[model samples]
Target: MDKKTIATALAMIPILGVNAGADSIETVSNPAPIQRASVKKTVTADVLNVRSGPGTTYSSIGKLYMGNVVEVISESGGWAKINYSGKTGYVSTDYLKSNESSSGGETSKPSGNQKSIQQVTSSILRVRSGAGITYSKVDTLHKGDNVTVESTENGWAKISYSGKSGYVSAVYLKFVEYVDEDSSGGSESSVIRGATVQRSSKSYSLDEMVEVQYIKAQNGGNLISRNNARTGEEVFTTYIIRNAEPRAYGKPTKDELRYYLDPANFEGYSSGLMQFVRLDRYTNTITADSLNKYFASKGTDCVFNGKGQAFIDAAKKYNIDVLYFVSHAMWETGNGKSALAKGQVVTSVDGVTLDKPVTVYNFFGIGAVDGNALEAGKLTAYKNGWTTIEKGIDGAAKWISDGYIHNSKYNQNTVYAMRWNYEYSWHQYATDVNWANGIATMMSSLMEKYGTGEGLLIDIPDYK
Candidate 1:
């Protein structure tokens, strides 16, 4: 959608000449009592100037890019006033038009049972008094904690925890199916009746390992080969189409990921099967405080202290999932203790020698690898950024945001989806079959540990 005011009579000087003024000036007199309904307009220009006043004489304070929607406040001769970036500004009336877009053409909202069971997948999930992060922490729950779901709203689950009902992030809760342990086997796995079953043990038997390996080999090749395939031929392929001069790829927001992954509702899928993840799959609610607190809980000094704010900043700036990004970082850095997290030497870039020796302060270990097979990947990331902590976080965030989480090309949002090699048969993020699942586990653990209570920030800072 685009928005702007009706152009002044003189705005047509180039097309209509000086004579176009007096008699040809188009006027939009202020509507009496104004339109009762708020007017939402789309910007039609590539870059429409946002002037401080309703005339061309007004100074340009900012810009309203094409497709940007703004509410029309009032109008003068040929100018429309609007609230731009929190301040009143005027855009040429010529570029503004009523928004005609639908809700992405969805015919109905997502449907689910009114009340259902969900398990806390986090190691320690904080129960808040309300739905938003600003709410006070009233209680806490642990990994494998079973709670009765009373209701859910806006990424939060209202549950009956510890004899009291409170709200927790729905992202950390997994839908489960409750079941009793069978007497045939001396083992018991908690089945919550409706949730996806949690894998009982991290370790597998020899037969199980062999079977997994066979499956992987059939799917691709060696485990290391799969791990090295993240930057495969598909990395060079373009997916998202941007509108800017450089025409870079665009990333998906959480909502967009949800829409694309939900095959039941959206029609843009090449495969109708919802192979990405479980129904409850989502990005955890992570913050800077969450990272710092998780680091402190480990009792080891980490470079991530005072760095949570940076992650939070980058997450918002890039529209990436804060929890997923931080969880992946923590997993790669061992809670910020890894040498790669501190900084590493980047000997070259795209196999070219740098003018001077360059070091990368990578947090997520994007291109870094231990073996000779993946050295070039590290250099590829260095050229993109990762030289410093902030650059590393932002660069890696953008990469993940555009590639794994919400790439227009692949559109794989879930970790399981990342392992899926649908289009390029060789594309996968890790060698081990459990890589995506392991990251999910780490995300839950981190959120349980630092996502709630005193560790949770009541007032998350808005960097934007």
Candidate 2:
């Protein structure tokens, strides 16, 4: 039997653009109402986008491109019900070739009881907090963390991170290493220069060593931790599409790594993802007290002390959840969108000249976003404020309404409705998952990788 498509707009309650339409103009005053009852599907697609509405022309919300590997909600006509920039929207299903029989199409509203299984990568790698370079160590590992390789984006590998959304550099991490060896030896054990080799009491049988290499025996031996060699920018191919001439991305790649990795780039900055970030917003936090402190630490960027203090203050204000804020900053600002993608993606070409146009800085993912919000509050996402990161993300799950639910949406489940706009065409269905999941993905990845977390799940910085 065909599911009945009811008109929710008549009720005055919203449902991800699912509300009553073509009814009475008097009923059209509310903001994007949220929720749903059923979902369309639960299959991954080649490319998907969560859009602003059920039809194209609304706007691009997020990109979910990856061949037929990207999972998504079921189908509505030829369109896939998608999450449009933290709201409920739909995208064309023409791009996806893979199909799975799951639920009705409801992108954000999920009513079923589903257990989450993490996606772990093949190799063991370093996990950090705060999405950018200055990651505070959370935990170290030896692979098989989450137990499965759920997804990949650009160069960022998404394993359970620790059950949240942990990420590692795919280029340096070694997803899978295939090597040809000379026979004759079963298993050989060698130590790094100046290191000693140890043997374990859980003795391995001859059958255990495939190509036996000589083993070393120590009194009461123990395995040693390796040094960090996977440092520096990884040169992996990401469809992220960077700009060369005229404009840039997030931050000039150089500035991005420098600011986040080096405490100095933050010399004159303030606290909170918003205030301390954008170059124009620099004056707010760059006080004399800030500068002198940096001069005492690292010593090199002593000249930049005052500038970086804002970050410290912001960290204090938000407490532990501060890391969650970092997720959006690093991704959008590329550490500091001021230098990298500032011009390239934040300009007039995209339609909305973002105030601080960078890849991740598109807070609220306001593709073609220009200027800050007309209002200044938690609700307003304009300007270089956490509001950009906060609302676009925190409100992600319930972004839609109750009138249009299909009962099968989970962060793990993919849907491609962000591609409803011409801007997101290359990323049809969803341009990328990094986008679709929003800030929730940030916290999820952080804790997953680090194995540590604190504070609120959706705590955004205060808006002024």
Candidates in order, TM-scores: namely 0.39, 0.21
lDDT of 2 by residue, 1-464 (tens): 33333444445454343335544343234334234433333323434555766556577665443221232344554665543322455667666543233475233212231212222222335655533346565544332222123333333444442134454543223222111222110111121111111111112332222112112102111111122331222110011212222221221222222222222232221111111111101112223353334224424422223333344344333221233333433344333332222222323222555566432223223333235321222122233332233233332212221111111221111111221112222222222212323333433343334323221111111111
Model 1: per-residue Cα lDDT at residue 332: 64
Name model 2 segments beyond 4 Å from true.
Answer: 1-47, 67-77, 83-86, 97-159, 162-464
Instruction: Give the per-residue Cα lDDT of candidate 1 at 460.
Output: 9
The candidate that achieves the highest lDDT relative to the unseen native structure: 1
RMSD of each: 18.3, 23.8
Q: How close is candidate 2 to the true structure, as a TM-score?
A: 0.21
Q: Which 10 consecutive residues of model 1 have the lowest summed lDDT?
A: 455-464
